[model samples]
Target: MRTATPPPPPAALTVPEVMTALRLSRSKVYDLLRTNQLKSFTAGCARRIPTEALRQYIDNQMGEAA
Candidate 1:
């Protein structure tokens, strides 16, 4: 019998990670953070945005654009 497979890892994205995902500049990402549209959370000493949140934001923006 085959055993169940493990689930994939949840993507934990840093500021630079998110920027790389979207091909955005560091300043542009920080601009979104400053504008109050995009939100970020700090874990310990590091700031990270949930990949789901970023994906949702992108989907919403795409929906609006279309």
Candidate 2:
């Protein structure tokens, strides 16, 4: 029998998804977006955050902590 490959992660994440992942409030997530700390873009009036940008933000936070 052949094994099936796992599905890939989303290329972008919703604000609520980010909030849950980062343990942040809705306002805090928007604040990060407004401050440009967390990069995001709009898709037909819906905002989405790229997975890579989220990773970069985490990396930056780690660097700052060190």
Candidate 3:
């Protein structure tokens, strides 16, 4: 019998994932979240950042930068 390998996770990322995606520091991520620059929300009263939103945020930021 052959073993089946698990597939990779989707783009639903957490706070740390957002930070890595944005290549930003932890404090900067927090600041962005505070300033409403990055899209996120509190799940079960805990803060969570979605990967797609972070990607969109990055694209917008790059657009602004350009």
The lDDT for every candidate, in the order shown, is: 0.83, 0.98, 0.80
> Cα deviation in Å at residue 22, candidate 3?
1.7
Query: Please, what are the lDDT tens digits per residue for candidate 2 over residues 1-63?
Result: 999999999999999999999999999999999999999999999999999999999999999
Where in model 3 is the C-alpha error above 4 Å? 1-11
Give one digit per residue, the lDDT tens place, for model 3 in 1-66. 999999876546677877776688989989998998887878787778767677788799799999
A best-first ranking of the candidates according to their TM-score comes to 2, 1, 3
Write candidate 1's Cα lDDT for 1-66 as tens digits: 999999885666899988988899999988887875567788998878887778787987899999
lDDT-best of 1 and 3:
1
Q: Pull out the clashing pairs in model 2.
A: none
1 versus 2: better lDDT goes to: 2
For every candidate in turn, the CA RMSD to the true structure comes to 2.5, 0.7, 2.8
Candidate 1 collision pairs: none
TM-score of 1: 0.76
Clashes of each: 0, 0, 0
